[model samples]
Structure formats: C-alpha cells, structure tokens
Target: MLTNEYLKRVYEGLEKRNANEPEFLQAVREVLESIQPVVEKHPEYEKAGLIERMVEPERIITFRVPWVDDQGKVQVNRGYRVQFNSAIGPYKGGLRFHPSVNQGILKFLGFEQIFKNSLTTLPMGGGKGGSDFDPHGKSDMEVMRFCQSFMTELYRHIGQFVDCPAGDIGVGGREVGYMFGQYKRLTNSFQGGMLTGKGLTFGGSLARTEATGYGLCYFTAEALKCMRNDSFEGKTVVISGSGNVAIYACEKATQLGAKVVTMSDSNGYVYDPNGIDLAYVKDLKEVRRGRIKEYAETHKDATYVADCSKVWTVPCDIALPCATQNEINKESAEALVKGGCTVVCEGANMPSTPEAIEVYLSNGILYGPAKASNAGGVATSGLEMSQNSERLSWSFEEVDAKLKGIMEGIFHASYDASVAAGSEGNLMVGANCAGFLKVAAAMMAQGITY
Candidate 1:
C-alpha cells in the first residue's frame, strides 16, 4: 500500500515473516508510512537497506519462569526480552509484567523504543522485556519468587552497559526492587546502574516516577503554544488509565491550571466534571490498590461509567490516552473530534489505533505520537544512569527541570522536522521523521554491522 517502492518491498517482507504479530506489524507500518518521503529524498537509505534491517530485531531471548504460588503449587510463565536495535548504545527499555506479555507485544514496544530513545537524544538503544506472570493478587513472596526465577535467566543477557531494563505495565518500583535484588545476589555486584526505577535510597533518580507524566504535559504545552498559540491554562482535559502515568499526568496537568476530568482502570472509568482528585487517585492506585469505581462513590458529584472505552466520549479541549495499546478505536477518535477536542497526546505506547490516528490527522487535531511525547520516562532513566555511573545524585527540582528542557527540545525537533518535510504542525509525521532521520543516519554510518 506504500507509494515508495523500496519501503513497500521491505514492509511486505516483514508482513510475511511476522504474520501473527499484528501489534508489531501495525507499529512498523506506521513508521514505514511516515518515513517514505525521507526515504525517497535520500537514496542512501535504500542502498544501505536501512528500513529492512531496522524492521528486524537484533536479538530475542525467551525462557521459562517457574515459581510457587501461595497454594503451594508450582506455576510456569513465559519471559521475553527483545533487543530491537543497539545502533546508538546499549539496549534500554522496560520490563512489563502482565498477562498480556508476549513476543509480539514486546517486539512492538521495542520497535517503538528505537525511535523513542533516538528522539530523546540520549545514548541508549532500544529494547524491551517482560513476562506473562500477573502481579495482581499475588503475595509478595510469590511475586518475589517469580522475579527471582525470571531474573535467573535474564541476568545473563543484561547489564549496566549492555541492556538496562526499567518498569512498565504491572512492573514498577516493587517488581524492579525484587529483580534488582536477585541480580545482585547472583552476580555479587552492586551495579546499581544495571537497572532503573529503583528505590531512591539505592541510586534511583528523584522524579523518575513523575518524569513520564510531567514530560507528556510539557510536550503538549509546547506543541499547543507553538502550533495554536494556546496553553493548558483553563483547558478541560480527559485522561484515561489510573496507573502511574495517568495519575502523575493528572497531577501535573492540574498544576499547570488544566482540569483533568476523567481516569479509568481496566474495569471502567470515572468522570469528575470538577476535576480529578489526584491525591485520592494516588492513594487508591499506588497504596490501597483499589478499583477506579470507588472514585465516584467517594465523590458524589462524579459519575462512573462501566465502559472503559467510553473515556474518549467525554467532551474536552484535550485528550490524553495513557492506557494500553489501541485503547482508542476509530469510533472513539471520531467522538473526540465531534466533542471539540483540539489536541491528543499519548501517554502510553501506541495508545491509538492506526485508524484512530487517521481520524486525528484528517480532523487536524494536534496529535503527539507516543515515541516523542512519552520519551520522558526513558530520558529520566538515562539521567539515572548518569547518576549511577558518576556516583552522584540530583535533587528532584534538578531532575524535573532537565526533564522539562528535554521535552521542549523534543517538541521543537518534531516541529522542525514536520516543517522541513512540508507537513507543518503534523506531529505524528514530525516525530516519526525526526526520530527516523537520526537513526537512519546512525544506521547508514554504522554500515550493516548489526
């Protein structure tokens, strides 16, 4: 379906080889479509087979993770680590612990990470790892045992300078703590830099948890100011998901004078017309680990909707989808446009389906792709890596300021790339072109050595 012959051939080969990996296919097709103009402009990319090679991962590791549950029964799970590209530096990504963890999903995440990491202007490459073990409803010991077993094999494949993994999905500070402890036990090395999202007392960077959420707003604010001469002040924002990203985004948006009206979990969504109470959300998700429906029960003015997909239906000036991949479908996207939503920024990996993206572009919505908008988390991890390597620590304000600066730079990079490609203000293509331009150059210069 691509107009460029070289890009089309490369994509077709990938589609044939990865027939079952729809998520990976969807991610690759999006990037391929965006970079076609760049490919035609620079024949060296085709000569170097950059697109073809970039579509394939450098390495994939899978293994069995066996552990004991509270019932005194042994359970088995699958673990995967996809090192998609290391053309820039060591493989760097997150470790997701969810029932949905699979090779295809990790490939999609890792593939996106290549561009995401490049957009940060950091030295880290792209990688992702996770397991099919659900951390929910599991005892601490059970989770610890699974972490140890998963790390028993994963430890050999990762390191401080090789591949450093962070947290995603069900994996967070608790899961990371367990895995880092196991790695230390096995290697007898206190290599704090080997992993990120660590507890603050142990080389973890301050503001890492808030980085992704705050960074998303920073990027959105920059995009709005530059593209529409507007800001987040007095904006009605609708956000999805009740996890760390969503919770922190609610906090930062409120700080910037925007009223975030909605948040959801897998069960459903809660809509608060007066603005979300982030303190309650943080305690509910981060502490009590309760469902989002409780929000309506606590606040009489708010209403709870049983359908999680209906989050986008709430009318607002801006929409931030911080949930899982494809959470917003074509219909949901149309609803946003109809509701007068002028901007859409992703806080999750591939939160919008390709069809949904089409709606955004056609409607002239200010769309910010996940790779560029959500790069704050990984960028802060890079700062953590620097701190660990240098045996130094930075204050929360210092890290937050750096994160803000990096996000502003990312916005300009994408905007400049968009203008250069004759598609000004289209951040979807802007992010892709900006990200691809850097990696494409790196790949061509490095030759086909990967």
Candidate 2:
C-alpha cells in the first residue's frame, strides 16, 4: 500500500528491526503513509538518511523496579524509558505506571510524542517512560515505596534540560507527588523541572488537569467550524473512558453547549440521554475511583452497557474515543458512521485502528487525530515548565487562554497541511506531515549523527 518506493524500502527495514513491536510498527506505518508527499518534496531527507534515523530511538533504558508491598513481600516490575527523538528539545513525555507498560507501548507513545510536542510549537522533544507496576489497589505507603525505587534508578537518567517526565495513565497528582519527592530526596536538591503534574502545594500549574480534555473540545470546535461551519453547540456527544481525559472532555463539551450522553471505564460504559452529570462524575472517577457502571445505580434514567467497546454504538453527532489503544475497531467505526456521527476525535494515543480511521475518512467525517487533538496536555506541561524556569506561576485563566489558542493553531496546522498535500481535510495526514516537517528539518540541520 505504501506507494513510495523509497518509503517502502525504509519501512521494510524498520519492520524487520522492530518486528516484535507492533505498536511501534503501527505508529511508524501511520506516519510513513502520510509522509509520502514530504519524501517526494525533499531528496535531501533521503540523502541524509533521516527517515531511518527517525524510526530508530536514540537510546532506550530498561531497568528493574523492585519494591515491597504492604504484605512485606518483594514485587518486581519492569521499567522502560525510550528517548525516541530529541531533535527539537529535551526528551519530554509522561511516566505511565501501569501493568501494560512495555517497550513497544512506550516506543509507540514516545514516537507519537515527538510529533505531538512538535505540533505544539514547544521546545520539548519526544520521550516516554513507565513501568509494569500497577498502582491500583495499593496502599499509599506501598505506592510511595515503589515510586521511590522507580525514581532511584530513573533519577540518574533525567534532568531539567535532559529528559523531563510528567504523569500518564495510572499516574496522577498523588503518584507525581511521591515520585517528585523521591527525585528530590535522591538528588538532595530542588529540581523544579524534574517532574511535572506536581501537587498545587508545590510548583504545579492550575489548569494542567483540565487542559487535555478542554483542549480536545477546543480542537473539535475548530475542526467542526472549519469543515461544516459548525461548532460543539447543540451537538450530542458520546465519549469513551471515564478517566481524566474523558471526564474533562465531557465537561468542556457540555460547557460549549453540547450534551455528553455517554462515558465509560474498563468495566463498561453508561449512557444518559439527558446528558452526563459532571459533579457526580468528578466525584465518582476522580475522587472515589469508582466504576462507571455505578452511574446507572445513581441515575435511574441511564443505562449501563457491560461491553466497554460498545460505547461507540450509542447514537451521537460527535464521538470522542478518549480511552485506551485500538478502542474503536472497524465494527465500532461502522456503528458510529451508521448512527450518523459527523466528527470523530481521539483523546488517547492510537485509540482507533487503521480500519476505523479509514471508515471515518472515507465517510467524510471530520476526523481529528490524537497528536493534534491531545496535544493540549503536553502544551500545558510545557507552559508549566516555563513557569517553573521563571520561578513564577500564571493564573488559571491565563494558562487556559493560552491552551485554547494553541489548540486552535494545531487544528489550522493540520487542516492547512492536508489541503496543501492534496488530501484536503484529511487531518491524520495533515497532522503527520505538519508535525514531521519541523522535526525532520531540525534533525537534518543537526547532521546525520543526530
């Protein structure tokens, strides 16, 4: 399917080297598919061997994270840090502390981070690190000990301008607080830029928590306006995942006059035709960490579907897959298209399969890729980094306003790039081409050793 002969050869080599890393391979293939126009435009890239270097990580660190639980037994977890590319800035990404953390997953995420961060026009490069240690159901003390052990090994490899990390799935304010504390304790110095998503009592930003979800809606609004001369106003939205991204996206969509009808966790999804309750959802997921199925118990009108992926089946004008990877498959995509979804925006990395994206694009749906739609989180993190460096904090309103502008910029960048590449309105291709141009230029300018 790769029509470019040069790209085909590069992808084959990349495939052979990273055959076991399906997620990474998938990420690379998606970018390659979009960059054919760029390759044809620039022979210097091929001469410089930039594509081959870009696919391969600059360095990868795998370490052992051993700690004791509340039961006084030793548990071991594998930790990974894939510094995929630093052509633009320091290796910057989140630390995901989940059971699914692996090299392939991190590489996929890190590779995506390169473009996501680049699209933000920020000075941060791409990197991702995490462990297979699930923080769920663990006592605070137990979690703290594991974070300390994880930081003990992670401290040496990261610094302010080196490779800064923030929070990701299974890692939040509490986890960040623990890890930041450990990093400080281990270094015996105040490293303000060491970790982001810190507690408010420390150097954390005000709008950091709501940035991603709010930004997703902002991007969606721009996409709607660009393609249909529309907005989130009066739209019906169905969003997957009850985590931070999903909840806040629901909140922002409702604020923009859209009715968010559904939200889900791993257990299942819940549909409330009357629109979701934000205060209740915030307490349930953010405070109590309760399952989304409990929404049905609390609200008599809502229905709880036991199948998580079936969240997409709920009828809506807009569909936001804010959940895990490959959440929206071909069947789910068909269901959304058949049900009359006009827009599909991703909040999670690689949340949609290739087939699902094809369905959205071929159906003339206004589709927003994850890199452009979900760049708000890292953009806010970058803002926090600037505030830290300046030893000052911006007001919540100031940060939120900046985030909105950046999201709008991202939308236009993708939309304009797609138009320029002869694939008018294909946001996936537009975003990939737009984000790649900046990083590719930086990499080429720095020479082949970069």
Candidate 3:
C-alpha cells in the first residue's frame, strides 16, 4: 500500500535492478515503506529523487586478498568496501570478516548504516566493508597475515575524514589491531582516527567493547519506560548470540535488575533458568572461543538446545536478537508473544524478518529497530573518533555517560518522529522516518552530484 507514486516508482526500480539481492531489497523496501508518511509530507524529496539516489551506493570496492597461511600456502579471499553514502560526513561502519560476507550483505548493512549513523546525530554517513574470510579456528599468525593482506588494499580507500571502519562479527580487537598496524605501516603515519575498536594501547576508547550491548539495554529501558511506564527492573530477559553485544547486554541488564536467562551462539543456545553467569559465559566465548553448549555442560541448572532460534520459546519479558540478520522469523515472534514478551529491541542489524516485525507491531509489543537501538556502538565510535582527533582518551566513565546520553537522544528522536508521523508508538516507522529525514535532508542539501 504505497500511496506515494514517487516512493512506489523508486521501490519498483530498486526491485528491478536489485532483484538478486534479497537482503538489500528487503532493507530498501523496509525503509521505503516506513518513510511513505514522510514522503507524503515532503514532496520535495520526491522531486529531488532522494530515495533513488540514497538506495544506490556511492562506490563499491571489490578486490582480492591473497595471504600465506600457517602451512605456507597461498590463499585468496575476496574483499569489499561499499561506500554507500557520504552526504553527511565520512563513511563509517564496521568491517565484518565472516564467511557470510557478500556484496548483498554488505550492501544491506551499509544501507542500514547510512540511516543508523544518521540517527546517532553524528556526522558519519553509511558504508560497510568486509571479506568472505572466516576467522574461526585460524591461528593468530594466520589471522594477522590475512588482516594485513586485507588492509593492504583497504588502506587506500579509508582515512580519518574519508572512511573509518570498525569491528563487526568475526572482526574484533585482534583483527582491528592487525589491520590498523598494517594500515599504519602502509601509510607510514599513525592516523588513529582511521579506525575505531582498536586495542587500548592504541587510540581506542574505553567502554568500546561493552558499548553496543550496554547501549541496547539503555535504549530498550528507555523504550519501556517511555511507552509502557516500565523498566528493566525485575524483568526476565533473553538475548541471542554470546558475542560482545549479547554478553554485554546481559551484563547491563543484570546490573539494571533484570535477569537474563538465555544466550546463544551459531550452533545452539543455552537456557539457564537461574540466570546466566556473565563471567563464565565471557570466559567460554571470549577466551576459550567455545560453543555455547559448554555453558549447559558446566551449569547443571541449564539446558542446551541445538537450534539457536528455539531460544525464543524459553520465554522472557524482553527479547534482544543480537545475532545475525533474520535470526527471528514469524514463528519465533509468535513464540515470544505467546511467552509474554512485550519489548523487542534489535542489537543486530535487521535481526527480525518482516513477518516477525509485523507480529511485534500487531501484538502491541514495543519494537525498537536496529538502526536506532543499535546505533550506540557507532555513536561511541563517533566518540572514539573525537578522542582520536583530540589526542586524548577519555576514561570509561566519561565515554559510557556520553553513550547513555546518545542512546536516550536517539530514542526520543525516533519516538517523536513516529508520533509526528501519526504512528505514535510504531518505532519501526519512527526510526526509519527519523533516520531517513536527516540523511535525506543532507542529500537534498548537497544537490545532485553526478
């Protein structure tokens, strides 16, 4: 039901051109659908063809990364950097090193980054880059060599005021350290601002590791408080993925008086009715790099489930899908609702499918889209960028406070935009519309740049 002709035409054109990229198309469609009300209000966006321009990337860099493995064998991996937009400022996003990294996935992430970064009220525009190189089970040297090879090509495309890349999924401090070291060596200059999520010895900001997870809870707490006059206190929470986002989200929620009952990995999920031990989970996932089933083995009170998606059936007051995209579908959403879940906040990009989102919205569940709820990581990255430029590293408390303020601001912005758009509590529409307005305005201001 796209009533606006311009929005409909743009979406149709996107479908025709990007029919093969379902992830990208889905991201585009979701935003376009949410912004219909905005389009109706602002006809000038249609005249300027803002949606069409915004949907297409500014540049896409794909190259080959060849490295020597521990066995002294040459291996080649495809690398990509999609500079989706820079109308507002330099391109800022994470470099994911998962095997699932592809043009479509990166495009979807980069497209979402444009709006996500916009929602942060930071100057960063959207862009995402990564390779099909999987870091799992790789030796330290092998990972280092691969990261060096990746940066040898990536260094040329990024700069402090150009594009700043951070960590995501398979990429972490080790990968960032390796890549930054290589980038510094190639350029023969120490441009700390060129990357965030660096090691503490470098120009990395404190609380950077916990920012996303902590930020998710902050945003979710705000959503609950504002919408339902509730908080995380005394609530049961379920978080997917035992990675940085999920683990820290669990920590923050527990600190805020909520008991997180479950955490999952790619292989499976662990349901601990007694609440997860953040220390033990961290040791297993971070240090040991072990599967989540280990938690069940260690804690007799916990039960291990083979299917990760089934984590939804365990039931909770709030659900945070910090795992990969589309991890939760319609059925999962139904289970969450049936389990008495009232709030759904995305810690990962597009974690819920369209059907899942519909279930949340139709069921009166408060839904916070990834762009707004998860922008904390990037917002803190923005803070890291500021610290880098200033040659000063703020303490963890300073950075965490700033992150909390930014998340609160984003929630209010999205809430207000949703209300103004006649969808008072639909955060999906609110976040999309609010994020789009800022970037669209910037794009319109910049005029056609062909």
The 10-residue segment with the lowest total lDDT in model 2: 191-200
For candidate 2, the lDDT comes to: 0.92
Error of 2 at 46 (Å): 0.9
Ranked by lDDT, top first: 3, 1, 2
lDDT of each: 0.93, 0.92, 0.93
lDDT of 2 by residue, 1-450 (tens): 589988999999988988899988888999999989988999988888889899888999999999999889999999889998999999999999888888999999999999999999999999999999998788889999999999999999999999989998998998999889988988888777768888777899989999899999999998888789998889999999988899899999999999999999888999999999989999998888889999899999999989998888888999989988889999999999988898999999889999999899889888999999999999999999999999999999999999999999999999899988889989999999999999999998898782
Candidate 3 collision pairs? none
For model 2 the TM-score comes to 0.99
TM-score of each: 0.99, 0.99, 0.99
Q: Candidate 1, clashing residue pairs?
A: none
C-alpha positional error of residue 262 in candidate 1 after TM-score superposition, expressed in Å: 0.4
Candidate 1, superposed: residue stretches over 4 Å from native: none
What TM-score does structure 1 among the candidates reach? 0.99
Q: Could you tell me the C-alpha RMSD of candidate 2 in Å?
A: 0.9
Give the per-residue lDDT digits (tens) of candidate 3, residues 326-398: 9999999999999999999999999999999999989999999999999989999999999999999999999
Candidate 2 colliding pairs: none
